[model samples]
Target: MDSVREQLQIFVRRFGLLNATCCEACCGEDVSLVQSHILFEIRRMGEPSMQQVAEELGIDVTTFSRQVKAMEGDGLVTRRPSERDRRVSLLGLTDEGRRVLVRIDRYMAEKIGQIFSVMTPFEREVTTRSLALFNEALAKVGEAASDGKNIACCN
Candidate 1:
């Protein structure tokens, strides 16, 4: 258990998720990991509601609102009121945001490519599957706990 925890910590840090800023060539701005994620999701979902992106990212609305405000200041995203629901704010990337997302995508792809280049095809497949399984399991656990179910481990 300790080994698993330690290895996961190392893996998280190795991904630079804790980095204060990304490479200039990538976003050419002080984009944090979370901010990059917001941009990526907006591009992927194509003008989703702010709440939708926040929920998908598992970020609280208040926290997500702040991040959106910052991104807006950076001119990477724009928010508009939904036509169907005046109260709901929809999020979309600006032209600059799209460019930034492209750079970020390329940068991440190159990094993953390098990592996979070292491993055999089978190894890569297993690694990918294991990570997906781990994520799914954790999500289930999180949902159960939040729903106030038997948190036996917590007890």
Candidate 2:
């Protein structure tokens, strides 16, 4: 039997999570997986500040800022100073960004539907539940580690 880590690694590879660029075919833009994720969070959060988005994504502010800058240059995102706080820069998706995100969403939904097509209804439900449980467990682990708990490491 494959270990949990091995299974997750295989899943990530199969899902193209490690791909350098993911949106070229679906959205006609050379958007990296990270950039796509950034776009997604921005849309989901509705004009979140850069620091907020970065924290939500678990990315460092400096690196996330650079990625946002590149996306801004590509005309997919806009950053403007907050009226309430001039120092805070809030992010928004451009019209083109919305179009691209919609296309990517459609593409992903189709892909996921295809993947689930072979599964029985019961299997799909079980799998979805298992994924949610796993995600919750992972988030707890992240919180513990961030709180400076001594998680065991492979030596």
Candidate 3:
């Protein structure tokens, strides 16, 4: 059996590639950079600033700022002054972003379905259990990084 750490690295790298490829096929040129900006900062969370995206990704603010500017050109994301705080521009996914995200979701779902199709029901059940364990372990790691704080899990 693979160690948890090894499997984690493989899972992240593989899924990360899948997402990147989907984004590249959906968008173009700077697709991965633009998609990362959305996937990490906007798609799942409420609108966040270019600054916030930079902080979360451990990148320089200027890098994400320029990336956001490029995405704005492609209509992937929008930046408008927040109603609550005019100084902080709210960064959000545009309709184009939402469409692309949905396509990516479908692509991933189809790919995952193909993987599961070869498995027996018992194998599927075991995979679900393994994923649950992986999630629990990831939550613990996230907590350790942020003083036991964790993200909300709808699941």
Candidate 4:
């Protein structure tokens, strides 16, 4: 198998290209890539704590906390005490964040549709079915749940 760095680099490169054509147009800034990723996932998952995002993305709590703070400064995302757990801060997309999320999601869906248009009927069917397996496997295995507190990485 190839190295993990190789896999990550490929994923990041493709992500940059995807955002350049879709997210960048709506956000008007290339640096918004990571912010969009965080905002999109949080919206989809409902209001997760900053710790949950850091856990899911394999980032340090301090790092994601700073990033969320910057987004708050920009008025794109919001933080509030969780009703169920007052000690934890629930991070959610503000109205501005929602607007950009919808736009970027639609753009990427269109981009994927365009890409799949080139595939043969059988290849398309196979690829489409395989995607279900991918999600199924991860849903059964990979989780990014919040613990309301920081956990040591690789512990």
Winning model by lDDT? 2
- Total backbone collisions for each predicted model: 0, 0, 0, 0
lDDT of each: 0.85, 0.87, 0.70, 0.73
- State which candidate, 1 or 4, has the greater TM-score: 1
User: RMSDs, each prediction?
Assistant: 3.6, 3.1, 5.6, 5.4
Q: Output the worst ten-in-a-row residue range by lDDT, candidate 3.
A: 146-155
lDDT of 3 by residue, 6-55 (tens): 97568767666546444665443336734554554687668887667666
TM-score of each: 0.87, 0.89, 0.67, 0.70
Q: What is the Cα-based TM-score of model 2?
A: 0.89
* lDDT string, candidate 4, 1-155, tens digits: 46855964686576564454445664454336667778877987798988788777666888788889998887779999988889999998888877777777877788778878999989989978987986676555544535422233332
RMSD of 2: 3.1
Better of 3 and 4 by TM-score: 4
**Candidate 1's residue-wise lDDT over 1-155, tens digit each?**
89997997798788876577864535565678788889989988988999999888877899999999999999999999999999999999999888888888888899999999999999999999999998788778867776533323532
* Candidate 1 local Cα displacement, residue 19, angstroms: 0.8
- For candidate 4, the per-residue lDDT at 46 reads 92
**Which digits, one per residue and each the tens of the lDDT, describe model 2 over residues 31-81?**
988899999999999999999998887778999999999999989999999
The model with the greater TM-score, 1 or 2, is 2
Stretches of model 2 off by over 4 angstroms after superposition: 25-27, 147-155
> Candidate 3, TM-score vs. the true structure?
0.67
Q: Could you give me the TM-score of model 1 versus the true structure?
A: 0.87
Candidate 3 wrong stretches, greater than 4 Å: 12-22, 25-30, 33-41, 50-60, 146-155
Clashes counted in candidate 4 amount to 0
